[model samples]
Target: MNGLLEDARSLELDRLRHDVHDHPETGLHLPRTQQAVLGALDGLGLELRTGTALTSVVGVVSGARPGPTVLLRADLDALPFPDGPRHACGHDQHAAMLVGAAHLLAARRDRFAGDVLLMFQPGEEGHDGARLMLEEGLLDTTGSRPVAAYALHSSASAPAGQFSNTAGPALAANGTLTVTFHGAGGHGAWPHRARDPIPAVAELVTALSAVPARRFDPFDPVVLTVGSVHAGTRPNIVPAQARIEATLRALSDDTLARLAAVAERIAHGIGAAHDLEVRAEYTAGYPATVNDGAEADLVGAAVADLFGAERFLRGGRPALVSDDIGRVLAEIPGVMTGLGACPPGRDPATAPGNHAPDAAFDDSVLPDGAALLAEVALRRLAAADPAAG
Candidate 1:
C-alpha cells in the first residue's frame, strides 16, 4: 500500500463502522448515523452543512488555492430487514471509506487546488435522498457547480479490491408500483352476490409475473417483482379492497415506461373483468445512473495506476440494481464506480448477495476505497488547475 492507502488503513474504521452497523437506521432521517459522521469529522475543520428535510451531511473542503470543485458521495442508510435494520448492503463500509478519505485529503490540503464536496446522504434504499439533497441545493454549497462528481459502492459478489463501472448506463432505471382493487364486501359463502377484489388482485399477480416474457422482447430484459400483497382481514368475508405492490426495473427509460403501462393496463383490465374499480399508482423512482465516458475512463485509469491493470474490470453491462446517485449524475457529469469488498474465506460467486442477512464486507478494502475517492478528486482538481499545465 502507498502513503494514502496506508493512512486509510490506520484510520480504524471499525469503531465507526461497528457503531453505525450495530445500530442502523433507515429512511430520510438517520439521526444517530448523522451524529456519528459529525463526530468523525469533528476536528477536520471542513465547512459543513446538515440537511433540513433529511439527515444529510454536506461538507465543503476548500483547498489552499482556488480552481474547480469536485464532489464525492456516500450513502449512509442501512437496508431494513425482517429481523431488524442491517448494513447488509455495505453502506456502513462506504461511510467509513469516505471518512477516511476526508482525513487523508485534509492532512495534505496543500497538494490539491479547488474544493471537494463531501456528500453523506441517507434514504438510498428505494428513497431518493440524493434528489432531496439536490433540491436543498447541494451543488450550491460552493460558489459554482461541481466540475466533476464521484461516488463508489461496495459489492459482496465481486472479488475484493476490484473496481468496476461502465461508461453509460451503469445502473438501471426503476419505479415502485402499487395497485389497489376496490369492490363491495360480502360473505365468502355468497361470492356471486357481491363484487370481490381478492380474485382480481390474485389474478393480476400471476399475469404480471408473465408480463416480461410475453409482452416484452426477451432481448431487452425487464424485472418486475411483486414483493408485497394485501387483502381482507378475514378469510370467510370478501374484502372491500385488495392491493399489490411491485418494484420495476429496466435498462432504459422507455422500457421502464412501457413496463409500467403494461402493468397498469393488465391490472385495470383484471379489475374491470371482476367488476371492480382499480387504482394503479406507479411512482417513478430513480433514473438510469449513466456515467460520463471520460469520467469513467478516469476511474479505470486510476484503479489501474493505484493497484494494477487487473484491478480495473473490463466489460459489463448495466444491471437492474438502482441507486439514488442517479439523481446527482442527472444534474452533473459524474461516475459511480463499484469496489469489491467481499470478506475473505467467502467466494465472491457463492457468497450471500448484498442485502442478505449474512452478507459481509471486508474492512481491509476501506483504505483502497477511500484512497480511490481521494485520488479521483485530486485528479479532477489538478486537471482544472491552470498552473498544472
Candidate 2:
C-alpha cells in the first residue's frame, strides 16, 4: 500500500464514503452530491471548474515541472429505483476514492510532472454525463488534452481489495430496443374476428429472445432482455397496439449493430407472418469500453507493484455492464479497472451484485482504490517525461 494512505487519511476517506452514501443523488441533478465532492476537494490546490450543463466538477492539479497531461475520472450519480434513490452501484465510493486520489496527488505534486485532471462526473447511470462534459469542453479544460485517462469502478461481487481488468473490450455497448405491433381492435370473446396484436407481440418477443442464439455465432455473445410488455387494457376489449421494450448488450460494435439488425428483421418477419404492422426502433447508447493495450498493462503492473501480484487478475471476459466513461476511452488511450469492494467474509459469487437494491460496498477498499488511482497517474506522468522529475 502507498504510504500516502495513512490511518488518518483512510478514516477520512471512510467518512466521506459513508457521508456520500447516506445522501445518494441520481442523474445530472445531483446538486448535494456535487457540493459534497467540492467540499472534500476544497483544500487541494487545484484549479476547479463546475459544469455549466450538468453538476460536474473538474479539478486540475499541476506538477512542479512540465510534462504530458493525464485524466482520472470518477462518476458521481446513483441509480434511481421505483422506491427512491440508492447507491447500490457504489458510485459514492468512486467519488470518495477519486477525491482521496486528488488529495494524495496534490500533496505530492512536487514529486511528479504534468497535470492531473480529476473528473467528478454526473449522469453516468444512463444520461451520458461524460459526453455532455466533452461537449462543454472537458478536453480543452486542461489546455493540453490528456494523453491518457483512467477510471476505477467498485465491484460488489469481487473479492475485497483485488484489482481486475481486461485489455480489450472491458465493457459492452448498450442500446435500447423498442418494438410495436399494430392490429385491429375487437371484443376478446370474438378472437377470430379481432386479429389480436397481443399474440403477435408475444410471438415476436419469443422470436426476438431467440435471435442471439439463432442468428449470431455462439462465441460472440449478445444479450437481449425484454423488460416490459404492454398490450391490452381491459379483459373484454382487444387492444389495437402492443409494445415491447428491451435492452441490447454486446461486447463489440459490429456485434451490437448486427444484434439490432437481426432484431428488426425478426420483428418485421414475425409481424408480416401474422399480418400485423411492426415498428422497431433501436437507439444506440454507450459504446464498448476498449482499453488501450499498453495502458492496461500499465494498470496491471501498477496494481501488482502497489499491492502485489496476487491481488491482480488479468485477461478476464469483459463485463456486460455499460459505462459512459467508455466515451472518454473512445477519445483517448486509457483503461478503466475494477476494485473489489465486497464486504469481508461474504462470498463474492453469492453477494448482491452492482445495481441490486441490497448491494453493499466495503468501505475498507477506499484507501486502496485511491492509492491505486494516484499511483497510476504518477507512473503515467513519470513515464511520459522521466527526466522532468
Candidate 3:
C-alpha cells in the first residue's frame, strides 16, 4: 500500500509525535523542535528553507504537470509554562500529520499538477510566527502565489477523527485592552484626600464589558474578558495608579475596531469624571480566521469523501480563539479546519482544552489528518485548473 495509509498505520508517526511532544519548546526559537522536523523530513527530495527571523521550515513539492501552487501550513511551537514548555495545543500532532502529508504527496507527485508549499511555522502562540513568515516572503517561495492555502488545527474539544469548522468567520480576531488610571495616593481614613484610581478602574472594567452589548449587534459576537486587575498593595492604603488588563476577541476586524474605540472612550470618560489621568492602550492581535465560503464547502466535502459524512461537523458558530493562520488566509484564499484529536476513551465534549497542562491528543489522528490535507490540496489544485481535459 501507499505511504499515506501506511503512515496512518505506521508506528513511526507515533514515535515522531512523541519525539516532538516530549521535548516541547516555546516561542519563535525552537531549535530542538526544528531539528526534529528536519530529521523527519530528511531525504524527502523537497526544496527546503529555514526562516530568517524564527525557526520556521518551508518545503515545496512540485508536481509532474505544471499548474498553480497550494499551501499547507503547520505550526511548530508550544505553550510556555513555569515548569517549561508543553505541547498542550497538539501542535506536535499537527507537525506529524503535515510530515505524513509531505511523504504521501512526494511519493505520488506525478498524480497531481501543482506545487505544494509546506509551511512549518513557529510561535503561533501569540508571537505571530505566521506574520513573520509572510514578512519573510512566504507566498513568494513557490514563484506563484498559492491558489489556495489550507491548515488543520487539532481540537481537544471535538472527538477524535471528527472535523469541524464554520464558514465566514471561523475564528476571532484577538486584541488586548489595558487601562491605567493615575491618581494620588492617600490614607484609607479619608477618601476625599486622594483620587482613588481603583474605583475608576472598576468602573472602566464594567463599562468595557458592556460595550459589546450596547455597541455591537447581538447576532455578531464580541468577547471582553478582564484577565487581571492591579491596584494598591494594602487594603487601607490608596494606590497612585490602578490598571486593568483585558483580552478582546471579535469575529471581524471592524467589530474589534469599534469595540476598542468605544472601550477607550469610556475609559477616558470615566477617568475624566473621576478627575484622574487615564492611559488606555489597545493592542491589536491576530485578525479573524475568515474561511472562504467555497473553500469551507470543499473542506466538508473532502472530509465526507475521505472519512464519511459522520466525520464532518459544521459548527454553528465561530470559535473565539485567535489563530495566526488567519494571517495567511487574510493574504490568500483558504480555509482553516479543526480536527478532533481528543485521545481515545475520554469524552470529547469534556476533554481538557488546549494549553491546559493535562490536555491530551490521540496519535491515530496523525495519518488521517495527513491524508485529509493531501486530498484537500489535490482537490483544490484540480479545481483550480482551468485547462482540464
Candidate 4:
C-alpha cells in the first residue's frame, strides 16, 4: 500500500510467492529457488554473491554517501511432509518480501546514506543455513559486518497485518533428547529369567515428562515432549532394549542444560532401580533468539509508522518454534519480528499453525510485509549517518 511498493510490484510479489509455493525445495540444495531469486534481482545494479557451501544469495546495495551497514535477511527453505515438500512455514512469502525490499531499496539508494546487505538463506529448518552463510563470508560482503540486522517471519495464526515481537528472548532454544534402555531378553514363558526393559522405559518416560514441573522453577519454563517411543515389534516377547526420543525447548542456555542434565539423571537413576543399562544423548540445536533492546524499539516504531499504531503490539509471549536466524543475531545486534499472515476467514486461535499440513498464509499481506521491511532498512540506514544534501 506504500508508494515504494506499487500495485504492479505487489502483483509480481504474489506471483513469485505462488510460483515458489508450487515448487517447494527443502534443505541447503535449493538451485531453483536460488535461480528464481537471482532472476528477480537481475537489474538491481547491486553487488551480488552466491553461496559456495549452500545455495545462499547475498546482495549489497551501497549508497552514494558513506555510513554504517545494515543486514536484511529472508530464509529460502521448505519443510517436507508425508507427500512431499510444502511451504507450510510461509518461507515463500518471506523470500518474496525480501525481494520486494531489495527493489524498493535499490530504487531509492540515493535517499539513504548507508549500505543494506540482503541475505537470502536456505536450510533454516535444522541445517543451520545462516551459519553456513557466515562461514562463506556473508558478513564481509559489505566490507564490514553490519551494525544492526532485521528479519521478518510470517505467522499463520495471528491477525492479518499485525506486527508482534518481544524485546528479549523472542524465541526458545531448541535441542533433542534421546534415551535408550537396555536389558536382557528371555522367553515369554520363563519365570523372572530376564529383566524386562519395558517397565524401565515406561518409568523413564514418566520421569522425563515430570522434569519441567518437578525440577525447574515455575517462572522459568521448559518443554520436553517424547514424540517417539520404540520397543519390540511383537507383543508377546520381552524386548532387549527400548528407545524414546524427545524434543527439548527452553528460554535460556542454563535452563536448556539443566533440563538435559535432569533427564539424563532421571534415566540413569531409573535404570539403577531396575538393574538395567540406560544411556541418554543430548544433541544441541539452535540457540534462543534474543533481540537487542534498541533494535526492538526501532522495529516497533517502524511498524507503527508504516502501518497504524493499532497494528503494532508489544510484550507478547515469544514463539516456541526455533529459527536459524538466531545464529546470526547472536553475532550481531538484530531483531527478528513476526508478521501476521493468517488467511481470511480463519480464526487465529483455532486455525492451523505454521508447519502444519493445512497451514495457509494470506497473500494480501505481501505488500505490507514488503513495505515494512523496506521502511525498517530505510529508517535504520538514515539514522546511522545522515546523507549530505
Candidate 5:
C-alpha cells in the first residue's frame, strides 16, 4: 500500500490534470479524453475493452486470488457550456484520479483479491451514459454483478484533501422539461385578431420559478429553473409558436414526479387562459445517488487512515445535484464521496461552482485524491474476503 502511494506521488498527477483541463469535451464526444485514458491503461495486466455505446470505456483487472468484484467509476463527460469546456466540473481531475488509482492497484497486484472494474463513463451531465452502458449488457458481460462500487467527486467548497460522504441520498434525481405554446398570428396593428403566445410564455416562466420558492421547502433542496425560452421572431408580429425549456432537480423520486406534474398542469392552465395551444414534454433523468452503508463505512475508514480521522466527514444530507454514477450505485453496494478541491482561504459561496464559467479546482488535492482512491479500492477488496479480515 505504501509503495502504491509512492508510485502515485510520482505519476505526475497534476500534469495529467492540466492536460485534461486545457481540453474539455462535452458528453459522449470526448475523443481526446478517450484516447488519453486508453493510452494510460496500456500494458497493465488488466483486460481492457473500449468503445461501449459512444466513447464510454471499461477496464477489468482480476486478481490472482478469488474474492468479490469491486467497481470504481469516474465520469468522462463535461458540460455543454463554453465556460465548462475547461476545468469547470473537475472532470479532468476525476479522470486523472481514476487513472492513478488503476495504475497504483496494478503496481501492487499481490496485495488484494477479486477483480476491480474501472469504468470511465461519458455524458453524465444529462445523457444517462451509465444507464445506456448497462442496457448494452455491462453487468451481464462482466459476468457476476459487482459486490460493491465506489466513486468520488472534487469539491470547491471544502478545503483541499478533505473527504466527505453521506449515508443516504448523496445527490438528487434530475428531470428535463420542454413547453411549447402555439397561438394565431396576425398583423401588429390589428387589435384582438391574434392570440398571443408571449404572454403565456411569460406567465409560464413566472409560475415555474415560483415552484421552488413557494411550493417546496427551501431547506429541502429542490430546483426548477427555466434554462431557455423562445418566442416571436419580430417585435411587430407575435409568433405562432413559443418554446420553453427547463431542468428540474429533487432529492426523492416522489418530489421529482410531483414537480413534473405541477409543471405540466401549470403550463396547460396558462395556455388555456391565454387562448393558446400548449405542448409540454417531460423526461426523467438520473436517479438520486444513494451510498451503501457498509461500503460507505469502508471508504470512510480508508479516507480517515490516509488523511487523519479529523478530515473524514460521513454524515450529510443529500444535495440537489444529479449524478450518472448514481445508476452504478443502484446496482452495486458502493459510496461516492466528495474531495475538498476548494483552495484554502476561499469562500465556497464566492468560488465558482460546477458548470459555471469560472469554476476551478485546487491542484494540490491531486496526490491526495489519487492516494485516497487507491486506499479505498484496496480496503474494500480486502474487506470482501473474510480470510483477509
Candidate 6:
C-alpha cells in the first residue's frame, strides 16, 4: 500500500486472481494457468523463460548493479475438484503477489543491485512440480543457485495480515498408500466356502490406526488415515477383491519409516488371519519442509518490517502437512514461510483447509503480501552484495 507498490499493479492483481479462480486447472498440466502467468511476467517487461519441465515458467529481472541472484516463486496450479474452479488454496493470490512484486520491482528498477528469478511453477498440488523443476536444472547452473529464496503460502488457520512462520520443520512428510485385498468370490449364504475380503479390509482399516498411535512414539506424531474404500458388488455375493487407499503423515523420517513397516505388518497380519491375499503399496511423496534457522529468522525480520513483532510469533515445531517446496529445501538451504491469510473472526477449529471445495481467501491483505515479497527480494538483493551499488 505504501513504499514501491502502485495502483495499476494492484488492479492487475485483482484481475489475475479472478481469472485464475474462474478457470482453475488441477496440478501439473496447467496450460491456461501457465499462459496467464506467462502473460503477467511478459507484461512486467522481464525476459520470460518457458518450458522448464512441463509448464513451469521462469522470469529474470535484472537490477541496476551486478550482484548475486535471488529466487521468488509462486505455484500456478489448482485442485481437481468437480465443484467449480475455486481458488481453495489461495494460489491465485500467490500468483497475484508474485505478479505484483514483479511490477513493483520493474517500476522502480534502480533501487536494487542483483538479479531476481521469478518462478511461476506449475503442479504444486501433490504433483511434485518442485521436484520436476529441480530435475530439469531449474535452480542449478543458474546465478549462484540463489543466495536466498523466498515463497509465501496463504494460511486459513489464522487471520488476514497477521503472518506466522516456523523456524524448523514447518510441514509434515506424506506418503500415499494403496492396499488391495483379493480372495475367492462366492454367495453370502455359505460363509465357509467363500474367501471374502470384506473382513480383511475392515481389519486393515482398524489396524492401520494402531501403527501411528500405539506402536510409534507418542511424542513423534504420525497419522495413517484411510480416506477411501471400495469393494463388493451386491449384498448377497461375497466380494473377491477390495481396495483401500490411505494418506500417511509424519513429522520425522524415522517415524515415517516405522509407520510404513507397521502398515505392511498390519496388512500381512489381517490378510493371514482373515484368509485373504493382501498387497500393500506405500509411495513416498513429499518430505517434511524443514526451514533453515537463519533463513527463517531473516524472513521473520522481513515480516516484522510490514507488521510489527508484537503481532507475530515464530511458528510451532511442525505439523502434519506436506509441501513440494521440501524438495527445494533439501537441495539447497532455504525457508518456506506460512502467511496468515485465513479469514478474520473465525476459530481455526472451524476453518476450512487448503484443498476443501468451499475454501475461500480474504483479499484484504493481498497488497500487503505483494509488498512483503517485494521487500524480501529487495532486502536479499541488497544484503547479498551491497558493494554492487
TM-score per candidate, in order? 0.95, 0.97, 0.97, 0.96, 0.93, 0.93
| Model 4 pairs in collision | none
Worst 10 residues of 6 by lDDT: 1-10
Error of 4 at 139 (Å): 1.3
lDDT by residue (tens digit), candidate 5, 1-389: 47656778888878777777777788776888888888878888777776656787788877768777778888877666643455578888898899888888887777788778888888877788888877876665457678888888998776677788988888999899999998998767873898888888999998899998888877666889999998877778867889999999987778888889989999999999998898999999998888888878887888776768988888977788888888887887788899888876678767767777766788878777778777877787787788786
What clash pairs does model 2 have?
none
Query: Which of 1 and 5 is the better model by TM-score?
Result: 1
lDDT by residue (tens digit), candidate 4, 1-389: 34765732544798888888988999999999999999888998989989988999999888777788999999999998999999999899999999888888888888788799999999999999998998888888877779999999999999898898889888889899888889988777872898788898898888888888888887778899999999886767888888899999988877888888888888889988988888889999989899988988888998777776898888888777789888889999999989999998999999999999999999988888888888888888777774443
lDDT of 3 at 298: 89
- Across 1-389, the per-residue lDDT of candidate 6 in tens digits comes to 24644443355577788888788887777898888887776766786777645787877888887777788888878777665556788788899888888888787678777788887888888889888887877775345678777888887766677776777677888998899999999999996898989988988888887777678777778889999999998999998999999998887666787788788888888888888888989999888888888778877787776667865578665778788888877766677877777776666668887778767677776777777788778877877775844
Off by over 4 Å in 5: 1-4, 82-84, 217-221, 344-349
What tens digits encode model 1's per-residue C-alpha lDDT throughout 1-389?
A: 23787787789987888888988999999999999999999999999989999999999888889878999999999998888888999899889889988998898788878999999999999778998999999998998899988999999888999899888877889998999999999999998887999888879999999998998997788999999999989879988899999999987788999999999999989989998998999999889888999999888888888888899985577778899898899889999998998789999999998988899988788889989998888888988899977
Per-model clash counts, in order, read 0, 0, 0, 0, 0, 1
lDDT of each: 0.90, 0.90, 0.89, 0.87, 0.82, 0.79
Per-residue lDDT value at 102 in model 6? 85
Model 3's TM-score against the true structure: 0.97
Provide the lDDT at 157 for model 6: 64
User: Residue 153 error for model 3, in Å?
Assistant: 0.8
lDDT of model number 2: 0.90
**Clashes in predicted model 2:** 0
Candidate 6: residue 45 Cα off by (Å): 3.1
Q: Which clashing pairs does model 5 show?
A: none
Candidate 1, clashing residue pairs?
none
